[model samples]
Target: MPAPSSTASAFLPVVPRLRSLRNSITLAANPIPVLDTYLNTYGDTIVVYLGGIRRTVLTRDPGLVQHMLQKNHRNYPKSDLSHGVARYLGHGLLTSEGSYWLRQRRLIQPGFHRQRIAGLVALMQTEINDCLEPLERQLAKQGGFVEVAVHALMITTAFRIIARSVFSNSLAERQLHRMAELLTAIQAFYVRTVRQPYLRPWQHARGQFRRHDQLAAELRDIVRGYIRQRKEASGPVPDDLLQMLLDARYEDNGEPMTEEQVLDEAAILLVAGHETSANALSWMWYLLAQHPEVVTKLRTEITQVLGDRPATFADLPGLGYSLQVIQETMRLYPPAWILDRVAQEDDTYNGLALPKGTLISGYLYGIHHSAKLWDEPEAFRPERFGPDQVRQQVPYAYIPFGGGPRLCIGNQFALTEMQLVLLEMLRRFDVEWVEQPAIDLMPLITLRPRQEIKVRFRRHKA
Candidate 1:
C-alpha cells in the first residue's frame, strides 16, 4: 500500500502569529488577500495557526482535494465549525453528520432528481418573469439609468423560486418578508460567531443563544404549518419538492420522517437552495458588466436562442455559452469559498503527518484562482468550460459545489436556477456597470461581495 502523505508540519512552514486572537480575527475578516499571498508564496499546500489551532490549507492541487474529499473521506469527518453551523441550521442534510446525515441524504435525494426538477421549469420561468417585468418597465421609463444592486435582486429571485417550488403560492407576503428578515438576522449572527470567538461568552450571556432559539422556532413553525396544511388538504397532490418529501419513504423501514425532521430539511433547503445561487448570479452579473465584450457575446447567443421568446428549460442546451459564463463566474468567486474537514485518524499527505482531530481547510477560492491550475487565473474566461474542454481538466480543480459523498445535493438545482435567471435577465434587459466596484471578501457561512454591485439596466428592444 502507498504510504500516507507527509503531515502539513513536515512539508509546509507554519504562520505562527495567526494563533493570536487578534491575528485570527484579521485573517478571518480579510481571508482573500491572505489566502492569495499564501497560495502564491507558499505554494499549493501550507499550514496556518488560527487561534492556536493548527489548520492545513490545501490549494489548487486537485489530487490532494480528491483524496481528502473522496478517496479517504471516512478518515476525515465534518469539522467542529460545522457543528456550530448546524446549531442554527438544525440537523438537516447540510449540518447532519455520521449516520444521521446518511439517513437524511437517502430520504431527501430523490426530491432533487432531474425529472422532478424538469417539471418545475415552467414555475421557474414565471418567477423569472415576475422579477424582470418590473425592472424592464422601470428601465424603459428611466432611460436605462437605475441604481439597482444586482445581488439584492438575485436574493429576492432565489427566494421566490425556492418558495414557489416548495409551497406553491401558499406563503403570504408578510410571512415571506418575515422569513427573509429572520434568515438575514441568523446569517448576520452566524458571521459574528465565526469571526469573534472571544465574543462567545458575552454573546451567550447577553441572550444571543435565546435569539437564535427564537429564530429557529419561528422558522420551524412556518415550515410545520405548511407541512400540516398539505397533510390535511384532501385534493390532487402537487409535484413539488415538499410533496416529494411528504411521499419519500425511509429505506431501512419504509417509514416517513417525523414532523421535526421534515421541517429541518425544508428549512435547510430554503436557505441553502437560494443563498449560494444568488451570490453566484450577483457576481456573474458584476463580471459581465466589467467585460462588455463577453456580455455582448452572451447577448448574441441569448438573443439567437430566445429571439423574442422567454427562455425555458428547452432552451438550456442552446445556451451553452451563457452556462459557461456562470461556470467561470463561480470559479472566480465561489460562494462556498472554504470547505473544512477534521481528521478522524492519523494521516499523512505529501510527507506531512496529520494527527486525529486536525482541521483541514480546502481553500477553494485559492485553488480556483491558483496559477498552476488556471491560466490568467484572475481574468474572466468562460470558454474555459466549453463543451470540448472541461473534461481534460483535473477532477477537483473546479469544485464550486464541492466533491465526494458529501457533494452538494442541490448542485443541479442551483445550476438550473442560475441558467434560467441569467437567460431571462439577458433576454429582457441590458445590464451595464455603473462603476468598477471594489471587491472585498466576506467569508462567513458563504463568501459574498462585500460591496453591493450597482448596475443600470436598459430594456431590450424586440
Candidate 2:
C-alpha cells in the first residue's frame, strides 16, 4: 500500500521489506501463485520493487480499479515498459498512446460497426467449417477419440477467418504460413523480453533482436503488399476491413493513414484476434469438458436455438446461456490475465498515493478470483453470469474484455467468432478431456494451457 519513497505511516500498509528475490523468481515462473499468496497474506494493495528501482503495486480492490482504469483514466497512460511488442510489431493500437492512439481508434472504429461485423458472421462460419473438413475426415479415419490439440485447431480456424476478413482473402497459404511463423516467434520473444529484461544482453548476443527485426520486416512487407493490392483492386473498393483502413480519414484534417500505419493496424488486428479467440475457445472447451452439467445446459440451449442447423448471427441473441457460458469461461481464464498502466502523475486512491512512473497493474486474475467478490471463486459456474446474477457484481470486478476507453475494439467480433465456433463445436461432437490433461496455466501474453490440451471429439448422436 505504501508508495515508494513516501512516509512509512502514510495512511497505508507497506509490503514490509518491499523486496523479495524468492517472490521475484515465483513471479517470473508463474505470477498467479505469487499473486495468490500476496492476496492472501498482504491483502489487496501489494507493492514490489523491480531491480530495487521500479515500483509496481498490485491492486485487487474493485472500486480502486474502477477509479484507475475508468474514473481517472487519463492520469494512467500505458507505460513504455509494457510496449515490448512495439520492438517486434511497431507502435499500433495496443502500444501507442496519446493523440496517435486516439486518431487510430477513431479512424478504425468504424470498421467494427455492428452491421459490418454481423455481416461477417457468414464468412466466419465458412472459414471454421472449411477448416473442420480435415477434422471431420480425421474423425472418420481415426475414430471416436480424435485427440486433437484444441489450441492449434482453434488458432488455425480463427486465423484463417481473421485473415480473410482483414485482407479480403489476398493472403496465399505461403504468405499466411510465413506470417504465422514470424508472429509466433515475435510473440515468444516479446513475452520473454518483457518477463526477463535483464537477459537482454544475452538475447542480443544470441542475435534475437536482429532476427526479430528481420522477421518483422518480412511481416510488414506482407501486410503492406496486401494494402497496396486493396488500393489497386480496380473495382469499387471491396467492403472489408482492409478497405475500411484504407478509407479511414482523420476528422481534423481528412488525412488518410500512411502505409506504415496501415501495416501496424493490420498486424495488430491479426495478432490480437487470432490469439485472444483461440485462448478463449480452448479454455471453453476445456471447462465444458470438465463441467458436463454446464455442457449439457449449453447443448440444450444450442439445440433449442438452432435445431440441427449451423449457428448464425440470428441465433446468438437467443443463445443467452451460450453467451453466459463464454462470459463465465472468461471470468475463470481471461485471455489478458493482467493489464498495466504507469502513473503519469502522483495520484492517491483508497488512502494510498502512487508516484509518477509507478507501474500499476490491476491484477485481473486476482480480481476475478477474489473471494470477496465471487462465490466459490475457483469453481466454473456459468450461471453466476446469468443476467440477474451478474447485475449484482461490480462493474470492474469482471473485466474479461477490460473496461474504459481502452476496452477491446474487437469485443463484438470476438464474441461473434466465439459464439459461432462454440455452436459448431457443441453441435458437431461430444467433447471430452483426453488423457486427463493436468491444468497447467501458462501466463503468456494470453492465458494458455501449459501442455498440449488434447481433446476427444466423438461425433454426437444424430
Question: What lDDT is obtained when candidate 2 is compared to the true structure?
Answer: 0.81
Query: Looking at model 2, how many pairs of residues clash?
Result: 0
Pairs in clash, predicted candidate 2: none
lDDT tens string, model 1, 1-462?
A: 112235545656555443334466566677677666656666677666554344555455777777789999988777877777677778888888888888889888888888888888888888888887777677668774666878889989988898888877777878887887788788889867766666789999999989987997887788899999999999788878888888889998999988888888888888888779889998998888788899888878977887867777767878899889999999999999888888898887766677787778888988898777788999999999997889877788899989999999988888898998887777777778786648676777787888888877777665
Q: Candidate 2: deviation at residue 100, Å?
A: 1.9
Q: Which candidate is the best by TM-score?
A: 2
Candidate 1 runs further than 4 Å off = 1-8, 18-22, 51-60
Which structure among the candidates has the greatest lDDT? Answer: 2
Residue 156, model 1, lDDT: 90
Predict model 1's lDDT versus the native.
Answer: 0.80
TM-score of each: 0.94, 0.95
In the range 117-155, model 2's lDDT, one tens digit per residue, is 987887788888898888799888878657778888987
Cα lDDT computed for each candidate against the true fold:
0.80, 0.81
